[model samples]
Target chain A: MKEIVVISGKGGTGKTSITASLAYLGGKDIVLADCDVDAADMHLLMQPDFGQAKDFYSGLIAEIRQDDCIQCGKCADICRFDAIPVIDGKYIVDPLSCEGCGYCPRVCPTDAIDMLDMNVGKWYVSTIKTGTTMVHAKLGIGADNSGKLVAHVKNEAKRIAEEEDKEIVLVDGSPGVGCPVVSSLSGAKFVVLVTEPTVSGLHDLKRVYELVDKFNIPAGCIINKADLNPQVSAEIESFLKQENIGHIASLPYDENFTAAMTQGKTIVEYDENNLNEILTQSWAKIKQIA
Target chain B: MKIAIASGKGGTGKTTLSTNLAAYLAEKQEVVLVDLDVEEPNSGLFIKAELLREEEKYKMIPQWNPDTCILCGNCQEVCNFHAVLKLGEQIMVFPELCHSCYACSELCPTNSLPMVPQKMGELKHFNSGTLSFIESRLEIGQEQAVPLIRQTNKYVEECFSEQVIKLFDSPPGTSCPVIEATKDADFIILVTEPTPFGLHDLTLAVETMRELKKNFGVVINRHGIGNDEVEKYCSAENIPLLARIPNDRQIAELYSRGELLYKKIPGVKEQLDLLIHHIEGLESAGER
Candidate 1:
């Protein structure tokens, strides 16, 4: 099975919208994976009927048992993140500040610290209105370990695709060159980088392109909002040529994107004429290349 | 007061609002605009800042000294990220994957592991009139951004002792980088569009600020194209709508060319003026 992940280093470059359109045009059997767990919005467009939710755990967090207490203050002294707070002569661990390095558990002389795996978020396997399987997740607010959660979502999507004998997995990856983006790009067969025609767009595209190069993965570019600035668009096209990256498509800025979004529908589902043809063409090119 | 502008999703005008707001506030106040979106620090493009200095930020990664007699696998066992690998008599360390937690070094049996500094990003300082700007740029292909962001914040706190108008352009998302940028701010400006995806991610950003217990307001961009669902949600949640910048093609054109939109946009300067006043009013009220 070939897995294709749509990513952009800069956000709001129409990654989700383009992924939704491709899913719609790719028939009704492709497995969808939305690895942007921090802001998973593909479900908004897909309207997935979610099944049972499973809690996902990642890394370990130290919890101080206050009852077995002698406030020796050893854990507080050795803690790197200063997560152990001293309040009114009592010591406690702030879960937000803890990095789960497994230090306090080993340093506690009184054996008051118990390190346990944390329940960071949840994942779901659902079917969209178009009868496509979608694997998505939600990471808790202020929660760490988003990279692991994204890996979980992708793995589940791959498993379901194998079981159902599917061939392609269309993934909507998170923004930036952080851990979550790394996990999303880890094992994907092909990457579709969707960006805009702006200075930030070109700048961040280079950064993500470098990351894709590091992974030694083949990638293509789709310049969203291509008409915003003709000069920058031309510059982006040149850069793609210099880097030997394929230019799959260029989509002009349209008010229909926001209109369809406000109406809780995909652009193809709303205005099927102008935008649909461009999107279907891009999808065809992607399929041919992948 | 320190103000951080953030959004849960990218390309939502965080840099546009931050640069324009800093330029507007720099007229009367000593504004330090920090582009903390290290992965893609684009505020420098909109605001012209004379280069002052640049420094490379480093994090600790383990270096194994394998000549301590015993070839125990303790370093590999304690590494949470699997950065340390034991291959019979040799060890391999992936510095990029290391979290700099010091777990492997602390647990090394024969004291053969040493924590060494590895450069991860660059911190830049620039001077633009009265606006002193700082921006962090993570090296391409690096995974750790929170440390560098925190380092930039620390540099700001140390370099400036007196009170100044600090505006942080945070990375898009409610993850580690966003938390690092917004955690210490006195107030946060949550930028969003009027579309459904905007509102959906705005809710997550709001939840993050609420969890941090930081005061914040929302600024709606591309106002005319999308519906009033964002405004309705803001009013329902009692989140003050600071300002709304209309969806103007001219403004988008100028922004795409890296032009500051304060004076160019028809009513943007006035809107930013009012937004600054509202923030100062909130700041004083908090003091009271």
Candidate 2:
């Protein structure tokens, strides 16, 4: 199955809205993966049912057994993260600060600390309103290992796509050039970079594109809110030309994006003519190129 | 006071608020604006400051020493990140997956795995009058942003006096990078737009801040475009509504050209003033 990952270096650039529209247009032939586990919002639009849920355990967290009488501060000294602290004369582990490096457990004199797999989040495999399977996850509050959760979601989507013989796996990637973004881009057949026409937008687009360029994946550009700034839009087009990235489409900034989101609908379901045609054509072009 | 301006979603005016707020406050008092969004730092694109210094940042990773090596497989077993693997006679170290906790180097039976510094990113310092701007950018293809952000916070602490107010423009999303950026701040300003995506991510951010137990307020950007659900949510949650930057075309145009909005736009300036006033209130309360 061909995997088309839609990513925006900058957030709130209509990445989710556009991805949802594309997924809606793709219909039953695609499997959707929302790899933005830190702040997963695709379900807000897609309305995926959380029927099949699984505990996603990644990395490790240090748990101190209070039964073993050890307030010796040995674990506190070796913890580089400062995760262990003396609270009311008892050494306790702060779940948020702990890095689970396993140094404290080895140094504990009484063996009070045990390194256990942390249930950082939960992933779900469910059918959305469009009759396509969506693999998404929600990261626990203040939890690390989001990159692992993103990889889990992607693998599940790809596995289901292969099993069901789906034509494509459309992934909504997280913003930034960090670990989660890197994990979302791994093993993708093609990339769809959604950006806007602003100073920060272009700056981030170039930065994220640098990451994507390292992967050697074929990429196309979608300039959302192109009318907001014509000069930057032109600059973005030229940059696309210079970088050899395909110019898919330029979508005008519209209120329908927010309106549709508020009504829990995709742009394809909300707008019948203009946005529908553009997104449908964009999906077709992606299939042709990817 | 160190104030961090962050958002749950990107392109929601973190840089816009950071640059303009620093500039406006710098007119009277000393301020340091730090762009902690190492992956894609854009505050420097707006601020025109003279370069003070530049430094290359590095992170410690395990380097195998063949002479002192023993095939104990201790490093592989102890490593929780899957960064180190002992295959046959060679130990492979994946720097991207390593958290630099020094577990492998310290736990090795022999001193086979030595910790060494590898170049990861660069940190630059710039100055414009009383406003000092610092930006740290991660090298492309680098996966970890927490180490660089931690180092940048250390640099800021060592270089600037405690009296100066520091404003950190943090990366978007509620993740490790965001946590590292806001963990030490005296207060955080969560900038978000008024939309479903905004509200959704805002709630997630609120949960993160609460988990971190941070003193934070909310600022609604692009206020006129979307619905008022964000305002209602803040009211329900009792999160302080800091200010609302109206959705103005001129503001967008000014921002597109890398221009500061508070000086040209009256609406934006008013919001900045309100923010400054609120910050001052927080400052006095802290002193009390």
Candidate 3:
């Protein structure tokens, strides 16, 4: 099966909205995976009928037994995150602050600390309105190991795609050049970069593009909110040309985008004529590559 | 008194509010502005400060010695963070994952492991005339922000005397990094716009500040363009609304040009001055 991963270099760049529109048009021919576990919002727009929530253990969370401990202050001193607290002459680990590094347990001379593999997140295999299977998850607040969770979601989606003989897998990846983004881009057929017309947007896009280049992924760019700053939009186009990246399309600002989100619907369902055509044509062009 | 300008979502003007507040406050009193968003440190975009000093700090992690090492795997088994992973025959260390707890070193059967410090990032001190801009730049692709933030606190404590009034530019989110930045701040100014997402995230920020037990007030940015959910939240929570800046095109243009908004908009300075004075008064009184 062919694969396409859509990502943006920055947050709030309209990656999910456009990805959902493409998924809507593509229908059951593909499987959808939202790998932005840190802030999973596609479910709000797609209204996916989520099913089978499984407790996912990513990293370990240190638990110190206060009764079995001495107030040596070694664990607190060694904890790089300051996750451990000195309370009433005792060291206690904040579940949220803990990175599960297990270093604290070793430093405790009294051996009062033990590592606990905490349930840090949950994953789901659901169906969006377009009759396509979707795998998405949420990383627990203040939790690490997002890259592992993304890989897990992608593996599940790939299994379903192969089982159903789907021809393509559409993934809505996270923003930035982080571990989670790396997992989403792993072995993907193509990457569609969505960006805006701003200095922050271009700077972040360049950063993420360098990462995509590191993986040798063939990529294209979609300049969203192109009209917001035409000068920046032109600069982005020139940058794309200089970098040998494909420029897919430019999108104008529309209040309907926000309206659709407020109504808990994809932009395609709200105004299928304009932006939907852009994704449709882009998908068709992407299909010709392989 | 320390005041942290924080927002739960990025691009909602965290840096914009913090830098302008710092610039405005520096005119009267000693002001220390901290850029805690180490992931993409940008407060220096406006505050032109001279480099004073720089230091490199790291989170301590157990360095395993192969000479005295036994492959008992006790350290690997005992580690909670999975920061230490025994892959095939080689032990791999993900520094970003390490919290420097020294567990592997203490648990090594052959006494082969020792906790050692490695440079993870740099903190630069900048003196811009009156305002002191303290910024910590974490190494790129490094996920150990909390450690750097902890180190950042040490720098702030040393540079910002108790008498100085400071404004800390916190990273967007109610996450661990934001928590680390705001833990010592005397007051928090939650900067937010008016939208469903804004309101949703702001509520989370408020919940976090409340849990931290820090005195907080709301600052409505782009006031008239959005809705009233944020105002209503503050009213119901009994948190005071400190200031409001309307959605003016000129102010937006100024920000786009990398200009400080408070200087461009006369409306902003008066509100900030009032807010700063009120915070000082509240701090002296020891009242929320």
User: Candidate 3, which segments miss by more than 4 Å at Cα?
Assistant: A70-84, A104-114, A272-290, B57-75, B81-97, B109-119, B225-227, B233-239, B248-252, B267-281
Worst 10 residues of 2 chain A by lDDT: A69-78
Q: In order, what lDDT does every prediction score? A: 0.89, 0.92, 0.77
Q: Put down candidate 3 lDDT per residue, B1-288, tens digits, no spaces.
A: 778888765556777788888888788877899888776676776778799999887778778677777677887886666778887766667766666766677667788778888887789999977889988876655555677877887888876678777778876655457777887888888887765556766776777787788788888877776457778888998989888877676665565446787766788887787777777788779744
Listed in order, each prediction's TM-score against the native is: 0.97, 0.97, 0.86
Best by DockQ: 1
Task: Give the per-residue lDDT of model 2 (tens digit) for B94-168.
Answer: 999998988899889898999999999999999999999999999998899999999999999999999899999
Candidate 1 lDDT by residue in tens digits, B130-219: 999998899887887888987899899999864677999999888767888898898899999988899999999999999999999999
Candidate 1 clash pair list: A11-B10
Report how far residue A112 has shifted in candidate 3, in Å: 4.1
Chain A TM-scores, candidates in order: 0.98, 0.98, 0.94
lDDT of 3 by residue, A101-214 (tens): 666766678899887777767899998887789999876655566778889999899999999999988899975454677889998999999988766677668877887888
Tell me the tens digit of each residue's lDDT in model 1 across A1-290. 89999999988899999899898887666899999999999999888888868999998888888888699998888776778999888898888878888767776788999888988888999988678799999988878889999999999999999999888999999898888999999999999999999898998899899999999999999999999999999999999999889999999999888888777788888987879889988989999998
DockQ each: 0.77, 0.75, 0.32
Q: What is the C-alpha RMSD of each candidate to the true structure, in Å?
A: 1.4, 1.4, 3.5
Assess candidate 3 and give its lDDT: 0.77
**lDDT (C-alpha) at residue A100 in model 3:** 71
